[model samples]
Target: MLEISISSSLKDAVNDFKIGVIHYQNIVVDTLPPLIGDRLPLYYETIQLSLQEHPVSEVPGVAEWRSIFKKVGTDPSRYRPSQEALLRKIKKDGVPHFVHSAVDLINFFSVQHGIPMGIYDLDHLSEPIQITIGSDQDSYPGLNGRVMHLSGKIVSVDRTGAFGSPIVDSKRTCVTEQTTNALQIVYIRPSMELEEAKQLIQKMAEMFTQVHGGNHEWKLMN
Candidate 1:
């Protein structure tokens, strides 16, 4: 019952801007777990360390965060946990593992791409997943009882609630072995160029194939 639609304007803009889209089908199993202990890849670790050291107040997006909160009616300053903190916990504690092929695939893709991606248990979601800005009350308790603030940024939501955060996800909507079909989404923000995004997507698809033991069959969006 899950329905997904990309707005005509958004699609047109993406086409005009030459944005890149990469889609993966079946995902691998073992890749979801951390390679060794709680250590993440260098890219993920570096970003986490930088954010922890700088704090949001000193970042270039501090002002933008304020504006986004105002627009979405949520206070970004009030929701100030470091992403590294959350990631480290997930790495150490282990996420609830899912068995769906598509869900696993996108998870790997997101990790490899160093961006946020999501997969919804299509059977569980309502039709037409809507993309919109979050409201003040749009917080969700994720893994480890952490509340995620979704106000003021784009999110893919169904009747069950948010499937993915801008750069993270809530365990509430995560896919599992019971999932039959899935709706996968990868966010290619405005800042990323088409070619670079495409290359990253390609690499991700290739990696999925190599690790999961599958053939490549990707469809482009823009």
Candidate 2:
């Protein structure tokens, strides 16, 4: 089973922070089905309308995340959280281009719930994972080809090193077509209760299995 723990270093910064993890096995990671792909345009439109009336800055979850980022020393405006970035992109582009089944699913939920999410291929990770605040010396190659300097950021570290975060995930553990087993992490905001977060993770995992053909389980960690 996949296991994760919050570091004492991170607890000092934000003790109430919680992470929801879903582990999936025997999954097919490919293009999303037309049924799901067809709905994204509608989801994007809803987000676009929502953003026009309520700016991303004023979003409850987004606002809380910005505050958390400041507490950790990173400029939220400079390195916006992943969910905020996605909302901005959808507002500007009118719709999001698909990545793959797993990624596309997570992106959809992130936008729907205003939560930051990260997914990694299980085969690439080391056991006994930890969530901690990044130091100045920690950096990883990002999915976008930029090297992410993780100082003061919330990051996931395995035995290997820092591989994932709320802002952006490292290329090292990114899920792709070859990924048969995967780990999805949801960064729950303070506005959500632990029970709500647990339900959300359960729903997400069920959806993944429903759409991607997988066996899955989820856990809540603090």
Candidate 3:
């Protein structure tokens, strides 16, 4: 079984923050079906329309992400939410043609709920995982082979090192075609209530099974 927890250090820094997760083991996806890609355009359109009322930064849960970033010593303007990044990319260019059902499913849910998410291959992780504030000395191989500094940043880590954060997930644990078990996490803003978090994660669980053959279980971590 996969287990997740928050360190005392992180709880002390941001005591009330919560993350919703959908963890699945024994998933199987060889190719992304047309059905998965077909729904993305509609989901993107709905998100674009809903976001008109509030700028991505001012979106209810967004300010909280920025607040945490600032508290952790990173410039909020520099590191935007993954949701904002996705929406911006879609608006300027178009909905990304994802490589597989796994990537597409998470991206779809991110836009639909307006929450930043990370999907990590569970087999790549070390046991006893926790989310904590990154110390000034910490560093990791981030996406695209670029080394990233995580000092005073909020990130998920295991025995090996940090793998995921609100800003981005590390290359070390990124999903690939070989990925069978996935650990999906959605960052929650203060504006999101527990019940809402539950619904969102559950929806993700449903969508995963619908798009790709997977069995999932979800829980909210406070």
Candidate 4:
């Protein structure tokens, strides 16, 4: 299992800072499972209706993340949180094609819960991860293959360096077809109770294992 800790400075800077980490091992990663695939249309329809009623920025989860981004000196409007970005995409594109089972599962729960979620290929990560704010010099190649500047941003760094964030994740740890061990990180909202975050992760774990065949564990890091 990977150990994660938050920097003291980061803890002092951000209010109600907490993250949910779900670790899975010996998991199968492939196309979306039958149950999820069959439910795509309904999910899309529901999301579209909800989005029509609430602007992306007004969403509770997205709004909280936007505040966090500002605290870290990142402009939420310019570099939107991943959940907001996905919601915008879904509003425009309707139902999306499957990426992979693990990716799809995380994405689904991310939007379902209105939080930003990221999954990394655990084999590629260095142990003893730290969640800290970034400096002007920190950067990494994002999953889109574009270099992302991490200055004044909240970032996750391992021995190898910066690999993940609430807004985006690094390509170095992005999940792949053969990945057997994975880490899913959820940005818990400041207003949400710890128990609520745990329940959300628990539900996600159950669904993921049901689809991907994995043994999992989760912890809250503050």
Candidate 1 regions with alpha-carbon error over 4 angstroms: 1-3, 6-28, 31-76, 79-114, 135-141, 144-151, 159-161, 177-183, 214-222
Rank order by lDDT, top first? 2, 4, 3, 1
**Whole-model alpha-carbon lDDT for candidate 4:** 0.86
State the lDDT of candidate 4 residue by residue for 37-104, as single tens digits.
Answer: 77977888789887887898898889988999898788998888998988898888775445887887
**Residue-level error in angstroms, candidate 4, position 67:** 0.7
lDDT, candidate 3, equals 0.76
* All-Cα superposition RMSD per candidate: 6.4, 1.1, 2.3, 1.3
lDDT by residue for model 3 (1-222), tens: 467897787777676778887888788765667666666677677666766665777765566677877766778787777776777666655574566778777777776666788899998998788888887666788763678778777788888888888777798898888898989888877567789778877877887876667688888888
TM-score-superior candidate, 3 or 4: 4
Number of the top lDDT candidate: 2
lDDT tens digits, residue span 1-222, model 2? 686888897778876888898999999988888998888888799889878888888888788889888877879999999988888888888776678999999999988888899889999999889988998878999987999999889899998999999899999999999999999999989668888888999999999999889799889887
Ranking by TM-score: 2, 4, 3, 1
Task: Tally clashing residue pairs in candidate 4.
Answer: 0
TM-score preference between candidates 1 and 4, better one: 4
Query: How does model 1 score by TM-score?
Result: 0.54
How many Å off is the CA of 66 in candidate 3? 1.7
Better of 1 and 2 by lDDT: 2
Give all candidates' CA lDDT scores.
0.49, 0.88, 0.76, 0.86
TM-scores, all candidates, are 0.54, 0.96, 0.88, 0.95
Q: If both were scored by lDDT, which would come out higher, candidate 3 or candidate 4?
A: 4
